[model samples]
Each structure stands twice: as C-alpha cells, then as structure tokens.
Target: MTENGAQLFARLETRPCLKDIEPQLFPEGGGPNHGEVVELYGTEGTGKTEMLYHLLCRCVLPVATGGLEVDVVFVDTDYSLDMLRLVSILESRLNAGSSSSAESDEAALRLCLSRLLVVHCSSSSQLLLTLHFLETSLSSRPGLALLLIDSISAFYWLDRCEGGASAIRQEEKLRKCAELLGRLLSDYRITVFTTCHAIKKVYNGPSSGSGYDRPYLCRPWQRLVTHRLLCSRQETNSVAPSAGGSEEQSRRQVFTVHCTSSGSRTKAYRSSSFCVTDGGVKFI
Candidate 1:
C-alpha cells in the first residue's frame, strides 16, 4: 500500500538525531565516509575519555542498539587510561542486558569482547600501527568499523614530545603529523574519534589578564577534522558536600558537553548533567 504524507511524517518523527538521543549522541546515516575526521576536545577530567568508552560500548552492541556490530580502534597516547575500569563497565553493562533471556542479545556481549582492539602508543610511528590493524581486519569478511583516539593533543605537548624543540619547527611537525593521520583515517574508510586538548590562550586586559581555551587550538589540525566538539566541565549535580578549599576525597569537576559541528550548534539534546560512576564511566 502506498503511504500518505502523514504516514511518512510520522515515520520521520521516529528517527532520532544525535542531540535527541542519550547513548547515541552523534548523528546517524552519513558515516564511514572517506576524508572524515572527528575531533573531541575538552578540559581536564571533563568526561572526554569516559565519553569515548561510552561510545565504544555502543559500537559493539547489536543493531537493536544502533550499533554496527563491528570492531573499533582505540589509541591511548597518554598515561591517563584505566583499563580495569573499562573492562568492569563493559562486563557489568553486558551482564545487565544479557539476563533478558534472549540468546541473540547475549551474542552482542560476546562479540564486543572479541572485536574490540586497543593500541597503546607513545610515538607517531606507533600511532601508524592502527593502519596495520585495519589491514588485518580486511582479510576476514567485511565491515570492520570505527577508530578512536583519546586526546590527540598529548602528542603535541612539549612535555609529551621531544624536548628543546623550536616553535616553528614544532608546529610544522605537528601540522604534518595531523595531515598524515588525517589521510590514513579517511582513506581507510574507518571512523576516527580523536580527542583533542585545548591550548591556553591569554587575553590581555587593562586590570590584568585572563586565560581561556580557544575554540580551535591548532589551526592546522582543525582544518583536517570533519567534526569538532568542545567539552567543558559544567556544574555537577553531585557536588560533594565540602569546603575549606579542599575535600576528604579528590574533588572532581563536572562538565556540560556542547557540540559545535555541521555549521551550527545542535539542539534537541537530552543530557542535563553526567555524574561520576564506578567502573570508569556511565551516563547517569
């Protein structure tokens, strides 16, 4: 039967955009396209790594959960990764979903463990190993998916990279590195979720000066990214009861995530605030 305009409109309304969804906060449909690079940047402890972990969980889920049921690449350049926490989060979530008595659903949990790949890199050459991993996946059948880097800025940081480097030379190296990584990510037809760090910018004033993280920290790297997200620590709903400029436990900052891409800021989003949970990360 031929559907009328109203029927089609109703169906369209059912489709969810990135902002409209909680677990899947990125747009759908236009994906795996070549020459595309996504940059996720935020302040310190602003749920950047945790967000990637969240997406990683979703990527391995079955089609029912908007996942491709495929593999993903994770590049850990910095030392701030919690492997045990990640495992615990994945296991706990899968177990909760698996108890539903659906055998097919359980398969999602199994496939996720086997398909997920992690690479720890401290150098640019090691970063290129991601391509080799992708190449290995091609031999099986088809549909090997997704790449994620938890903060690309660490590579460019003076302390992270070589010491006593020239400013112009340093930037040039960074630019070329960005260009190189950008090409591989696009050409390979793999989704790259790269986390970037914001550089401190000083604004001079009459009274004094204040520093802020600019929207785009690296101009050269910025041009290569297909999607760029700025994540900042927002007011935490679970602001621990503390004072005296200190707390019993480590005081963690909460952040409100705002995405700016595809021409303008996206509306129709869900999350008001995300709280810290056990086993690494989970949106609460």
Candidate 2:
C-alpha cells in the first residue's frame, strides 16, 4: 500500500520502480514507496543525518506542500540527536512562506510537535526492546507515522572484530541482528530509515592503502532492505587529498538510492554542497 493507505506498489498492482521516478530535490514525497524498508548507508557524516532532519521538518508540513500531515518517531541509538537543530528546521519551514498558507503550516507544525516521539538507546538490546515497545505503542495510537533508526551499525562493537577465527563469530552476530531487524520490517509497515556504515577494505600486499573500494552491506541484512541508498561525502579535509574537484569547488555530498537484489534499479542521485550550521545541514 502507498503510505496513505492507497493501493500501490503492492501485489497485482502496477507501479514503477523508485529509481525511474525522478526524485524531487527538496521535497519529502519525491521519493518512492514510503512505507517500505528503505535503508540509507554511508561512511560517516555524509548528509544522512541532515536528510533525516529535513524529513522530520517535512512531516510537519501541511498537505498543500506535498507533505503528509503526520508525526515522526526517531529511534536514536547513538544519541546523535540535537534538539535545537530540530526546532530550527521546523521554524525554517514556517519562515519560508507567509500568508494563510504560513498560518496553516504553523498550525500543522504545532500539531506534529505534539505527536512526535523520540527514543534514545545506548545498547543494541535496549534498541531492540524499545522498538518492540514502539510497535505496541503505535497500534494503540496510530498517528505515529515514520520510524527512523539513526546509525544501526553503531550498535555493534566495531573494534572487537580483529581477524581470522574471530571474524566468523562477528559475522554470526551481525547475521542475527539482521534477522531481528528483518522481522520488524515485515511486521510493521512504517517507513524504516536506517543509517549504516559502509565497510571498506584495502589490500596491503604491495600497494599500501591503494586499491581502496566501496564495500557492500552485510548479506542477510542487505536482502531485507527493499530500497538501499549510499551517502558519499564530498572532498572534505578528512577525505583523501586527491578526492577530486577543483580548488574553488566546495565539497559536495552524494545521495544515491538503489534497490536490493538483482534486476534493473532506479538510480536517483543527488550531489550538492552542504555544511553543518547551527541549524543543522544547510545546502550551499
């Protein structure tokens, strides 16, 4: 079903793939299949957080502006949320326009604020339990619209996996986590936005730090995400020195969305220069 209880993209229904539908640059409804398991992956700080915050603002927007007048459920496992930043994005929308529409937007904003809920977690087990509780909570109150799990990979113990024999155990652990997440997706039709760490490995044989390439997501988990995206950062100071672009060109972040399994998938790509301001990510 389409996000608003509409019959679309389901069995026996004809619908185009997300990539085929050109993504609206700054709008929330621009993307495809909202109430599905969609994953956003990147190394670190490549606008995943920013995009998520922007989405939060959009949910508060009135229906006139292509936004669903609904609520947001943010599950912050990494404690990466910034409250002031949230208010900034909400206020920016109100300030963007004036007249009767602005008044309506403000009203919608207030209502959404009342409905919004956040759950913070320090451990993977807590995160899982909280989500289970959320499922029960939402059934009682159906207005809890979208559910976002920021940085799912952060829950795992990153440094614990060294090499050789230990790698097998790590994979098994990862596989189990993926299984749990998959079950949740099937049970709930909420839009699941998860931020993942894209692993990268280098061959240290003869070429030191050379032949570096992008790595895929973990297997079973990868299959669960119907729509997957990669957020690549611009050539910032932390990035490689020869990371492309000119002297005057400011760094740009990439948002590339694709599908899971085989077949042709839509590649809705976006590359824009942005920075983290007091108001979160601002497109430059």
- Measured with C-alpha atoms, the lDDT of residue 182 in candidate 2 is 61
lDDT of 1 at 122: 80
* Cα-lDDT of candidate 2: 0.59
**CA displacement after TM-score superposition, residue 197 of candidate 1 (Å):** 2.4
Score each candidate by Cα lDDT: 0.58, 0.59
For model 1, give the 10-residue run with minimal summed lDDT.
Answer: 15-24
Clashes of each: 5, 1
Candidate 2 residue 250 C-alpha distance from true site, Å: 8.5
Tens-digit lDDT track for model 2 on 36-81? Answer: 5566776666677877787666665555654555666888877989
Give the Å shift of residue 76 in candidate 2. Answer: 0.9
How high is the lDDT of residue 86 in model 1?
71
TM per candidate comes to 0.68, 0.66
